[model samples]
Target: MPNIFSSLKNAYQLFKHIDFNQLDALSKKVDLPKMVETISSLDEKQLSAMMKMMGGNTKKKELPPIEGDFYHLGDEALKDADRELQLKVRAVLEKDVKPLVNRYWNKAEFPFEIIPKLAELNICGLTYQGYGCPGKSNLMEGILAMEMARIDTSVSTFFGVQSGLAMGSIYLLGSEEQKQQWLPAMQQFKIIGAFGLTEPEVGSGAAGGLGTTAKRQGNKWIINGQKKWIGNAPFAEVTIIWARDLADDEVKGFLVKKENPGFVVEKMQDKMALRIVQNGLITLTNCEVDEEDRLQNANSFKDTAKVLKMTRAGVAWQAVGCARGAYEAALKYTQTRKQFGRPIASFQLIQNHLVEMLSNLTAMQTLCFRLSQLQDQGLLTDEHASLAKVFCSMRTRDVVSRAREVMGGNGILLEYDVARFVADAEAIYSYEGTKEINTLIVGRAITGFSAFV
Candidate 1:
């Protein structure tokens, strides 16, 4: 009533310079109980004002949530139910997967325990129709890819091999009986699947120069060759081996079971990236498949490209997730870590690093969103998917590098989370199709010139 706020502020200023340790010693010579009681009796507003005065302009602005998707692309675009599912999946990854991921990454092992929980999500074959698949749009599938990869890229890779490459091969080209035989069980995680495409000497040029060969016998097709970097092949119950026909020189797909006598898988080791993914060097020494097990409609490399064209969009989404994960980790670290007696995030130079990371992340996310839209509309071409893959993978490298830079030395430590993304990005950059191959696909579309040669 009588300008009590001003009086309270002055009293707070008086107490501001008083050292609590020195005050404790001085209290022995004064009426300590009365002085403490007087200070404690201040009302809520008075106390807040007094604290503000004592703290001396320490009222920092509350920063918004450190979201990697600054443009709210996910929120603005996803339907209510899809958005809910997205968050639910993210919570599961954070609670169940994120806590245990680094340990598995260190050991280069898969957490088989998560298979049951992952199966419960019922997200396999997200875009395919029937055969226990979700039959959702490609957009949803892309989002789920991002969600899985946000926590562990290896798990995402495992899932992609099963759902996109292996299952997709069957879904797109197999006979109805084939889909019925594989999709339901694979969808439930009862049967794991791997895709074998790239050979040791035929990586980026695999589409044209597949070295794996399949020779037709009386009632069986005998496959012979090596497949390098076949994800999940080491443990997959079924591996879809792509081999060229000796008769017509056409590429064909075979569902090679793990117990096949002539099929051998050696676990690839000493990998510098995506260590948790069990990539295999698969050797097919006269691996025999019944004609019934052959992918019925897969007659040529074009059918195989159909599978790659579909999965390549998902790979682009995975790149976005990788970048988002790294950017978010770095942003949170910068906000709390202090340099020169202030939070490093408060500095302009550090803010510039953050902004650039966000810019790249946003660009990747938006591009993937559009790519998924095109896929959903049934307008997705190889060139469109390839362009997104190339752009997102290339930009993700930049984002992860910036993320590591912002964290200084801690960025390289596995415990920090970003180092894994940084390392995993290298694999994402190379796999599916290398940057050069994907760029050529897009290059041909824009200029109508085949630059792949």
Candidate 2:
């Protein structure tokens, strides 16, 4: 051991340059006593070399904020409280959802553990006026949808089928008794809901050509047919099954309980996209439904169209999220992944890809923001929603492709996140409304000609 006085002198001189705050932080990082002892054994020349290296002028420049929200809409457009909720949901996704997404996606299973916590957020039935829902504006709902999709589109779709499609069917068309019986528990997620409308035979032309038929027999309606690509069906407690009323020759929505003897749901397998979502093929053979369970005010296909109009906006928001998530992931990878001893992000070609992604992402966000505004104002027509759905889904495919291009092989891997976005975007593009169907909706509005066949 060195003399106490000499050791004290050397330690004091060595630490003199470090301010107290930094020293305190350093002490928390390392064992100070062992460091002091080890340093005391160093010769004067060695100590000088160590000190010179430690004090080398290697200042790291702060990187610019690389966010997918290239536009300031999250801050400028949302109210303070809405913005706070937006960030809170985003935090939950990044912290809780992202880590387990790949494993669940790989296994093609849903993470049921996160459901209760999500229910606790009380965001279900977001646009509804009562029955335990937050009664938040359409803008808030759209933002939350975007946030969920940004992390994982499968979860967003599951939630949408629950909150928007199933609940909206009841809220917009159900009688007071129907709403009172189901809305509260459904809003709390205690009784998860599914919306089944598309059949194996009918998809794009659902309005005019529904195969599922409901025959009213005395006090009960007998529902018979199949629903394909029904999200959350296998696990949902209640499913809103849309079928044609044989007497009226019009579509009507029915609430079918999972335990009902006539209802059978089988999980669809080998799905390439949104695999984490529990989609099922539901077959209803003589499903007995009381007249009370029918959506009382759903007299025709027009009421079902109202529910579709509302949920379609949510799908547009989801498409925006899919693009944003992939863009952010690719941008981060470029900055960290190096080629030829330098980050690929520094190259002009890579930067060009990044810029193209940002441009598309920014446009999607802004478009969805305005779409939600129109929804809130009650100015959202089928054509308006369809136009947004068309534009955003198409642009999202472009953005995710560029994001995949930037990362090369890693882009195709599930672990890199962009791959999942790429796959999920395909489902978003086709579902809710297909590209061709939505195009005609807009075309009919612009030209006053119903090009839809």
Candidate 3:
């Protein structure tokens, strides 16, 4: 009896290794579980006869690896080098950044180790000419923004602050000498930068209601006031501080270095979204900057709007990435998770959720692609960006919500990846421009009436 038991155990172990496709084919005609149970109760002769009845010609079908970009937009659109760069960047985010992002996000701490590799990408000032910049098209810049936000939005925000808002201010408004002085090092990430425009009291209204004041005296400019939600300001080498000129009543941009005697930055804590972005409450109390540090061409608030115009489009792209990330995570989750003895993804209701997510995601990708194209052609308007921002941000909220819903209880947990997108979407919706503000921008363009007060 002991010998028979040992033989039966060995036979069952070998049967377990049989190709699933063969089992599936056999299952079409036979009651597999009943047959297995009956065979287990049979003598060795009966089991051998059953094994012979089943042919060994089954071959496994190799399915393509599951990927997020279902439409292959990324592969078809990007040039070979740009696509390679995108893959490299994605690899870094997947291997190094994604694994550690959730913990840092929970603790609201920035990951400093990835900075060197990020700097090596040489993507800073990607759309700018000269000054050690990559001088790529705005489309490439937008694509990179999407790539970053697809993994972690806080890091994307940090990069946007340094590369778009801060460097763009200098690139667009700085004098030739100012560009020569700052652009090279800043472009290489040797010196990090921040842009301070939003105040504690003013956010979307900053263009019209800037409370920070800058008074020029002799060759120095005295800037006084506070800036809130200033990303990267806590550790930035230099900050592009926007303050209303006391002399001319015009908005001006000043380069306030971190070591300035009167410049102080306190980290803002307890943020629910983009916590790893290192937002700061910056106080400029009698902070004096040399004339050379003032952005030479930033004569009015309109100049600051130029920088916003460029970065806002990138924000729209980020929204698409955030949605893509959540949708992909949810899609992957459904495939492996089992319920009722089958993959949850195989259910009709679950497939409906996936299709909805894919629909919104596809729309956002196409919208951002056109937005970037318009930007590259220098034909982009505030309304164009606002439309994309409004549509993508709003739809992203929906996509992430559905993504969470499909995952059942695991959706709300940070480890699942969908939860972060759900939280981060709020910040993206509000920043750059609020939904109402952006919608008003679009409304005014089509109707020829400014509804904003």
lDDT of 2 at 124: 92
Off by over 4 Å in 1: 1-19, 22-61
lDDT of candidate 1 over 244-269, digit per residue (tens) = 99899899999999998799999999
Per-model TM against the reference: 0.91, 0.88, 0.88
- Show the lowest summed lDDT stretch of 10 residues, model 3: 55-64
After TM-score superposition, what is the CA distance of residue 204 in candidate 2 from its true location, in Å?
0.7
**What lDDT does each candidate get?**
0.89, 0.90, 0.89
Error of 3 at 366 (Å): 0.2
Question: Model 3 scores what on Cα lDDT?
Answer: 0.89
**Judged by lDDT against the true structure, how good is candidate 1?**
0.89
